[model samples]
Target: MLAPTVGAEAAEAVAGEEAWSVHMQNTNVLQGHTKIRSPYYGTNSLSQAPQMRQTVSLDLLLGLRLWSGAEAHLDGMMWEGFGMSNALGMAGFPNGEAFRKGTASPNENISRAFIRQSIGFGSEMEDSPSSSLFLKGRQHVSRLTFTLGRFGAKDIFDSNAYANDARTQFMNWSLMANGAWDYPADSLGFTTGGAAELYLHDWVLRYGFFQVPTVSNGISLDPHIWKAWAQVVELERKHKIGSHPGAVRFLVYANRANMGSFQQTLNNPLRPADITDSRNYRIKYGICLNADQEIATGVGIFTRLGWSDGRSEPWSFTDVDSSASFGISAKGTAWDRPNDTLAIACIVNSISKVHAAFLRQGGTGILVGDGRLSYGAEKIIETYYDFAVRGWLHVAFDYQFAVNPAYNRDRGPVHIFGARLHWEF
Candidate 1:
């Protein structure tokens, strides 16, 4: 059922009760991907496979007023699902086991339950889940947030644009291409611990550590990586150019993610003697710029540019030069109706060939050192549309294409398709 202008009425009716909101989205999809490999590419050829994937997700927000002007907030999400293509197949050798077992992509694994809470220092308010939960005064100078449960990470560009759960194609593809995370499979990807976030003035910082699977022969449920750490800091100064609604934002991030390091078993299935030390021990620094313009009453255009430098150069492992990569995205949205909207976006990525020299092979593999690994250029294009059928239900469609898919011959172009049915409460 559709309800019109219920904001004021709902606020009045729930004056003394804790406020909460929940959102759920279910998607049943069919995918058909064709990989084109020429003789010049290599000795390998791909099979045209038509795959099917399905998923269900829930996102929740809980808010409670601690005082007249302050509140306590908790947010969480859960995913039960499946999808296609695990990046492990491309993350070098031996890591692709999880992807093969699912008969689908690795991102479709599963999402562990999670929750985060913070107390506001001031009196501002939040009307949507996307709104800041910090109090008015606290968000001005400093605010602190802590999480002790299992959960996924959020993206800097737009929380809704990139996948937060890391349990699906849309999210995994974007993050992997940007070199954000080393998630080969969904269920095996996230850490089991907690994190904290602090905001000070125009700068925001976060530190988090998780319990991940180790490089052993255990199943997906087994934890091994011991510990995974991630840190991100953002600083922004919005400059108004004339009366137009235009602004710029800057972001920086670093992560030490150990996605099942090296092992003689599953991680190094190629045999200890044949196993190569291709682990991705990364130290990364990145920067991004975001700008937007209100072109019309129901339309807007936005663009973002980002670059990263990985000092450790996972490809090289040791004594290797760092690697640099950059990406750009342009988006347009038409909000003609309050409940109905059409959104479209395009993105591209470029990684310098110098990074290829960092790729190393252990023992006696097809390719040794940097000579066997070279990614001249790689790119991906993605677009999706969401239409709110009513207040509680929605539908979406997405398409993706990849070119010069990085990695050796065993992997394909990474093409994908998606459809979703969503309901929110």
Candidate 2:
């Protein structure tokens, strides 16, 4: 993606831009984990058996200017393959590109189809660069933007410079996002919704409402819009510290749906300790704090803190109650490879007492679950080095170590090695 250009809007810059833009990207990730010391296993546990797994994704972005300040975009996407243990076993799953809905063959979908209208308020402006998400041209700094249709909530909120993209940055589930936010989405992480963004010179406020799954982590969304939906609000502040730039975002979200109760599951444990046996229409809310700062030229740091009420099951995202992570990203400019990147991050994930107790009673979640439990906070250490092979093509190597896998201390201290290849134009 092109960097944000904040400056005067030039006539030529606007004239040089096309009325429509098309972009294409593809990513392939292969990962393998070492044999783990496991005495037992569950259906949803990260397989202790050592094996290699892979996932591939392709995206095509099309954007067309509808009017002076209106644009429409359609994203065609295809995905194939699976994640380790099918993206199960841990709250901080190690493969961001891997979706739980794996396919033996390529599956296609309209990942994003949205319309955006931006109303500029001030005379000051900057020439924006072309990217897959939005159009490139001159735009005012202080503006009100409205977006509607199908898209991923993560696309609008929790923006981070150092640890956001899975194809190019960190590959862990928690590292790429505020794991505990549980933003509205379907199995493939897309949802039908609308978002409004108010952008001021130094501050940004955004609100979004979207449909959630009818059942926990289901593919189909409930049609009872009022009864099953999600609403989120985020406040962002961009600042400069001693010539360095940084941004902090505070977010809060509430979800309403027919979700299961952890306490209810434990109180009346089923044959398999199924939480869904106690489903009810309830609300789950949470908050998140995210920050990213450019500490020095070519070096940046990022961190995220998130928590969600553990009363209900995770309706959309991973199985996590609380999460915290921080890391550093430094470009290889020091070694003359400006396009290269090196980064490392750590994560801590935990569940509420009731949530953990449910698992101890042989309950299962969207991800983390074992037949029995010896609970502990899940800890992860991940590092990667991306090499710019040439032009838009790049290759990267990644490594991750997990302790107390799936919040079970009785399990691992597993080591995972990975490789990724990505290209875009």
Candidate 3:
């Protein structure tokens, strides 16, 4: 949905110009779940349960044009809130110290203040805050976009694409693309910190500088904290096969950092890894294909494939290893009733080791896994319906099922039923 824009409040070099945008969504959900201790410790049993959740968000932006080919912006999230476990999946311990410290809350306060410029002859200046500079020339395409300060690492294809709603809490699992989900405990894998994006033709590359993971520091010396792990850098490419109905995207990415290495340099101030030795690096490569064809009246199909390796050789950790997951997604409007849309999707996740070493008792992140090696992988299936009530409002119903022997031990599956209402303009 596009937010409406109005004329500037002042004409002085476009200064003092401001605009506001808001997004609100709410959802009610019911869920059933069960969990077993471990494969060798429990019998196959299922427990019945139900749950509820709510979410709200708001964004405000202000822009000012400094000179030709240059502009500045202040965009911030004014109101961000989430309640309950509407089945977004846990990114971290939902009730951990981070939450108690207010560092991690259902309600988030995030913003970015940045500027942009175009430096070249024949360059066209566009009012874009996200892209530092974008240039298009005959037979050539290049964009140098850098986002400093703070901003979201979200994209259309993978980042919270399906599960972000004001009425429903953002499903954390939906935030990850193929490579980001390989190891859940690796905090340096993907971060929403200062990052840059460079695009050339069908390819887009990105990298970020963020905080180190798995460290505890005293409050007085918190600002002295330094990063222990390597910064994250990734590359993505999307290309059209031909005029035919097909397109493909490939990704190659790597990041190195010390996960648990932290020490106090002075006065109990936390200092990240200063190791002269080689830092542990985890890398991934993935390819996905998207195709579409109208077989009949308002009917279509979609599919995707993904795989990744979670292990980094020459490292201190030996638990998480290779993992492969794939899914097929299809959505088509009913033949007779073109106004009604039906969508279905299923994704399966597999880990190389039986139990995930990353989420063990001694490990970090969300501990949904059993202490024993997972004898098998986990699976999730989701189906949803989207019906357009108007141009700006939509009503949707969704159902999801997640099954993992390691996390739920003997618990068979967790099922969630949800209802959503969305209004974006």
Model 3 TM-score, 2 decimals:
0.59
lDDT of 1: 0.37
Can you tell me which runs of candidate 1 are displaced by over 4 Å?
1-23, 38-52, 55-82, 85-142, 155-172, 175-178, 181-189, 192-228, 236-249, 257-298, 303-340, 350-374, 407-416
The 10-residue segment with the lowest total lDDT in model 2 = 1-10
Q: By TM-score, how accurate is candidate 2?
A: 0.96
- What number of clashing residue pairs does each candidate have, in the order they appear? 11, 0, 13
The alpha-carbon deviation from the true structure for residue 2 of candidate 3, after best TM-score superposition, in angstroms, is 19
TM-score of each: 0.60, 0.96, 0.59
Model 2 misplaced regions, further than 4 Å: 1-14
Task: Judging by lDDT against the true structure, name the best candidate.
Answer: 2
Q: For model 3, what is the error of residue 282's alpha carbon versus the real structure, in angstroms, after optimal superposition?
A: 10
Over 1-425, each residue of candidate 3 has an lDDT whose tens digit, in order, gives 01111111212222322222222222222223334222332111122334444333344455555554455555444322232332123221111111111212444333445554434332433332221111111211466655544333332232222222222222214212332322212211212335566666556666655433342211111122242332445555544333323334333333333322211111122222122122232233233333333334444343334443443321211122332333332334335545555655454444433124433322222223333233445566666676678645667676666665334334445655556565443
